[model samples]
Target: MASALPNSLFQQYFNNNDYADIIVELKHPVQDTNCPKSTEYFPMHQIIACSTSTYFKEACFNAETNPIGTKLLFFDISLEAFTIIAAWVYGFRGSSFERLFTEKSIRGVMDFFIDHDLETDIYPEMQELRTLLLKNLFKITTEAEVASATGSPRMDLRSLEDICEYCLPGDRNTIRRLVKQQIPQIKCSAGWLEALAGKSAAGFLASILLEIYQEAQIQ
Candidate 1:
């Protein structure tokens, strides 16, 4: 890495900073009849990297020098309001297939949604996020690939029952430990379930199962 490289190297490289340069608003006059403010303002740059690094892959290291998959993110920082706004006019406007899978943008979007201010205008923000997820979903392998990984073909009810049996009562503690250990190993999300069913059944089952899991922990 070059010493003179921008301090936002990680963000720049991973987020395609070369193409998505932050638009900095320099000192400019505000048109206010009551009180016109003319203050010397410099573009303050802020780089926020994710606190968790588990999801990011090793190939991300080559992003700076290679043409690997990376999302182009550009935003404006306002010190006065202590707020950051997406400067969509300055960079790639929407999420594309090239951006999501290679990078951990999906997880980033999930983390962002966790604390997102929904009261504010969320339609545009969510649309962009949805675009990213859909594009990535298209690149995912077939359901058979998942079955191959789990050594079970298309998770049937028997498999679900077997897993559930181990997660009950005395077996529950052991199952919890196993779940923690295998959280990364087993892909059991709405997305995973959908892959198994090839339809909308996953959402219905996920809601029911999540409730079951919650109730089971109550006693």
Candidate 2:
């Protein structure tokens, strides 16, 4: 016998701006030329943000401690990125993905996910978003002119270590291409290499080293 699917009560309220209980204020920093330093407001359901994000969950539920009180302020994240994140929290996956899925926007979203502890084991949506972001990042990394023209931020050693951890055993091509592109700059910094050696998994570390060695040999 075929079983009926359970009703999603929240889906009814999804995208209903009138029912929003929280207001998220996003701001861009003055130093970020890609976006204007301005504030933007996004109406969101407290329950949806709290349920999906640990940081929000703590802030919204533990009002006595956090004292968010219907309004939350976020600094240095672009309005476009926050809009996409807020919409995703409310299950609004639409054409917005095309507009919002840029290198800078993905980085902002990933920062939010990391701060909120949205790991794959705990929040499947976060994992899905991570994969999507990785694809966008890969595309940017592959196009040298585009990357340079956009002034893509260089990934730090810690960020590289995190990427290795996230990407290893799956997206080897992306990692290889990234390593090839960044090896010259990274090789100059012995401190970065040492940091990567200390943090990365043995197998992943070897793969990166192999890529660097191959690039050097080719040169």
Candidate 3:
């Protein structure tokens, strides 16, 4: 087997724009006249892109079909989302890159995956995360319905946008009926944002979601 190239080499290739063979552009999902997504452009090597991505491989190498010298591909995703993926492919890894995936940004990334119907293509680990984000959406929606009827504050919300981007709407009436009284109270907590971003707080979040899903499972 041939030897793998060092990440440093790819890093150099990524940074030196004059040597770039392809340009990947991020397209805004929304078309508001006032504001839009970052719609950023990233120029890189065809070899790096083709080696790592099947989509780019098919596009770049299909010379007969793909027009020669036309290298711009529109990626309808958030800048923050594309940055994380692009950085990883170009040898920019670690926590700093991960920080780019804020709660809102990850939701936007997942929206791109969901829009392309690429949920089936995600890794098993990512599938779990997708499931969790969807479940959190469900948990909150159900609680909201219950609260509307019983007059209580919505509880244990992970993020509706985070979930809607991945999962379909569930039966609003069904989960509402399951819990007549909202046993889960809305209590302010510190570090909730940090907790939601990592797996460290997953158990706690899962427990809350479970309680809500299990009809508050309370006496």
TM-scores of all predicted structures: 0.26, 0.54, 0.52
Error of 3 at 68 (Å): 6.5
**What lDDT is obtained when candidate 3 is compared to the true structure?**
0.53
- Sliding window of 10 residues with minimal summed lDDT for model 3: 171-180
Candidate 3: C-alpha RMSD to true structure equals 11.0
lDDT of 2 by residue, 1-219 (tens): 111322145445654567677766667676668876787776667666666655456556654322545645444577767766665555555465456676677777777666656644555556666666776665554454345544543444454555455453555665766566544444424445555566545356555655676566688
Q: Model-by-model lDDT, in order?
A: 0.33, 0.58, 0.53
Q: Candidate 1's residue-wise lDDT over 50-121, tens digit each?
A: 111211112123223325433223222222211112221112233432332432333334334333332123
> Who is ahead in lDDT, 1 or 2?
2
Candidate 3 lDDT over 139-199, as tens digits, reads 5565565666666645345442234324422322333332234434543233453455355
TM-score: which is higher, 1 or 2? 2
Q: In angstroms, give how far residue 196 of model 1 lies from its true place.
A: 15
RMSD to the hidden true structure, all candidates: 18.4, 7.7, 11.0
Q: After superposition, how far is residue 61 of candidate 2 from its true place, in Å?
A: 1.3
* Total backbone collisions for each predicted model: 0, 0, 0
